[model samples]
Target chain A: MQKQKIIFISLFVLVIAYFGGSYLYKNWYTQNLDFMAKENTSVFIRPHSPIYGDANAKNYIIDFFDPACETCKAFHPFVESIMKKHPGKFKLVLRYAPFHTDSYYVVQMLEAAKFQGKYDETLNVLFKYQNRWASHHSPNISLIWAFLPEAGLDVEKLRDDMKKPEIDAIIKQDITDGKTLGVTKTPQFFVNGKPLIKFGYKELQELIESEL
Target chain B: MPPLQKTSNLAWNILFLCWLTATIATLGSLFFSEVMMFPPCIMCWYQRICMYPLVIIFFVALFPLDTKVVKYAQPFVFIGLFFAIYQNLLYYKILPESAQPCSQGVSCTSDYINWFGFLTIQMLSLIAFSIILILLLFFKRKAI
Candidate 1:
């Protein structure tokens, strides 16, 4: 009887300890991913990257996003809402990773929008009408052109700007940097240069609140 | 085995059902997390803490037909049920987003396997906990 009791107690404790330890380890490792600049930290931000929120904010959230990626669009407003809540405490810096099929053109249009100071508006328009234009099979780049009017840009000027070689180079730099930083998918976020290893909506808020 | 026959057959069956529920629930969770590669959220961990211990306790108690397993094992059942209910509510969106407890998208905020577009892993857990709780109560009332 005594031996059986001891065995049961041992088994119970062992099960709890093993799983509990694993859970704690995962959370601890992800939340403390501030080892900072495992690769070139310089690749995190570029001069061409669009900066949202206060330019002088100390907490820099470097986002690697795709125009056509569904989650990137869904979480855009959520990320914006978080930054809005904190007000000047954080800056959301955008880097383009045109991972989807034909997303390169949408990215080009966004970069070109920078020339007319309509980058943010153009991005909003693209995301708003993403379902109409973006698809994994073959994105309708022409449909995106129709929506550019919503962002109130000069169609001719935007067209001339989109063909610029510098914009293409900027996109290429972002893709290269994204690979270095281990951005395997769209909507990847880094808080204050620390990667968000957990990659959940709740986790995103937690990371931002922690930095704040 | 003679000692087991000394009790009512219904009690033995109820106890056996409880053990079976616990065992299946434990293995089911492992299958989801390990085999299916679905990540459990923080709420699942809390419920796991309650359920895992009962497997051992019930297993030990059954071999000797010890009725006192209820005193200790019942607590775990109740705790597991609580968390299971909370998780189901969050997963089904019955609870508000503000009440969400899982983080890193591994938990409540992210979608899990939605079998037939309705059932989910959390719902499976809820059913397991409920069955065990009902069997335990039945055993206590009629068998004990």
Candidate 2:
């Protein structure tokens, strides 16, 4: 009985410590966000960026993202959920960083699709099929075109628009701005023009919620 | 007096807790990768190589109350700890991306789930290994 009691207490302590550590870390997360938000920047969101959710929403999330980034692919669903949860409370302005070798082509494709009012559909398809064509090490860039049909995009028109100087300029301006802002990574987010001090889903959500 | 015996009891209990922790870590890692579909990077695989063996070895030792389990398990636990520390360094950008072994597959530093802005998969593995090492060391000293 004593041995059983000792074992029970031991397990209980470990469980408590796990939860305690998580709780304490959450408090620290919030404090760090508060510190990071002290100096909000005007250049976080650009006028030409693609907007998701309610464009009129008071709280904005300016996200610098690379379509080829695996982490960005994973985070896409979570980011969509924020807009779902808050309705018109928040919106996201997406800035293309195009960090990977083939990511520039994908961003160009996205801009071309946007011209035909297929931005959301193309974005969804790209993210869904990211693993196939967006690989950082050995990206099969040609394979991305095969998935466009599923997203209801006109292949010939998309190809034509992809070569447009305007599309190139959009990609270039976003990349320049991202560099100026010291964004060395994909899926870098700023909530209400205040950069996230750390990268975490909970941290991003909490920061956006606080702004809302 | 009773204090010495109490210490012995605590150490023994901690050994049991170590087993429990390893069991959870093993299962939790599987759940994340298999069920949750969070792909494991190369470092994660290395850590798994170290941790997976521990679950079986620890379970075998638990039934017989074998203190010799610690002697056999220490190397694997230590290796797992090493990988976890290396992973944390990569995740924090303290180590350069060029040094990452995951050049072909998933990026080693990718954030799968940063729970509470701190607990990544690597951090969780580090915590598990640390507890197991400390508990085993304590029990070894107590001659459990």
Candidate 3:
């Protein structure tokens, strides 16, 4: 009976510690958001980060995304449609968080496409044919190469440009920033530095609307 | 083996409680997956398979108190308890992710509803299965 009581007390303490830990972690998550949301924080935006809509827009949507994430692919059009609702009011700055295996290679393809002014079509095509290339278990760069032509990308130019150091630096910085922002999942969105703390399509819309 | 003799109301009631446990567990699993729309991971599905059938099996066993129905239900309880323990191990990351299913889409590790930040759907299943297994063992001893 005494041994059982000791075991029961230990389990109770462990449960308390578990709840306490997540609470502390949540506080840290909010504190990091508050710090990065401050104006002119380089962590929010870098010079090379891809942006859609008016660059001068007051409202910024920082999307920390993995190219291979299914949720990110699903949210792609939804986010665009959201921007369409409030034209020129919001600028989406995409930050790479390549959490998936071999997603870095896909990110390279995307960053390389920018050099030839085919970034938009490339992103669309990659998303369209994501299942063929980003197979989760065995991502194949060759398969992505086959689909790039549909996006009118100069395959030769893209190959050469992807080997550059600048794209690598951009990915590295975005990854570092993503960690600092407490991004554990893909399609993590922040509007004007305020994170979409509660995850839902409706929550995203509300956050965007409030910022608007 | 001799047939079960006329048992007291307390014994019958306790046996019925086993079915009640299974019934509640089935409804809870359905509620989380169907109503709440949280997609069940592969591990969740496996645990459900080992759990859902016991509701009917135990109910059949209780109405007549057949030893054979209890025998059939015992394997399910043991299997479900194993799944519950294995799932908790995977959920807590004690087991490596290489063995985990749904590594790509709708990550098995994704905390759909983390109650008290520690108790997850898997942990809840673990608790339910553990209780049912214990009750079933006591019922088995009473049957003999």
Runs of candidate 2 with Cα error greater than 4 angstroms are A1-42, B1-144
- Candidate 2 on A1-212: residue-level lDDT in tens? 76656556756776676556555755664455445445534356656788778867888788899888888888888988988999998888899988677778988999999878899999899889888885554557799889999889999999999999998988888988776555766788877756665689999888888886
- TM-score, candidate 2, is 0.49
Clashing pairs in 1: A200-B105
**Candidate 3: tens digits of C-alpha lDDT, residues B3-107:** 435443344555666766676677677766644446677777878898889877765665545656667887888888887888788778899878976676557
For each candidate in turn, the interface RMSD (Å) is: 6.8, 7.3, 10.6
Q: Each prediction's TM-score against the native?
A: 0.52, 0.49, 0.58
TM-score of 3: 0.58
lDDT of each: 0.80, 0.79, 0.79
Candidate with the larger TM-score of 1 and 2: 1
Q: What's the number of clashes in each of the models?
A: 1, 0, 0
- Candidate 1 lDDT, A39-75, residue by residue in tens: 4456888888888899778898888998889899999
Write model 3 residue lDDT over A1-212, tens digit each, in one string. 54335334644655565556555755676667777678447888898988898766788988999888888888888988999988889998899988778889999999999999999999999999988887764567788889999999999999999999998988999999887776767889988888877788999999999987
**For residue A68, what is the lDDT in candidate 3?**
87
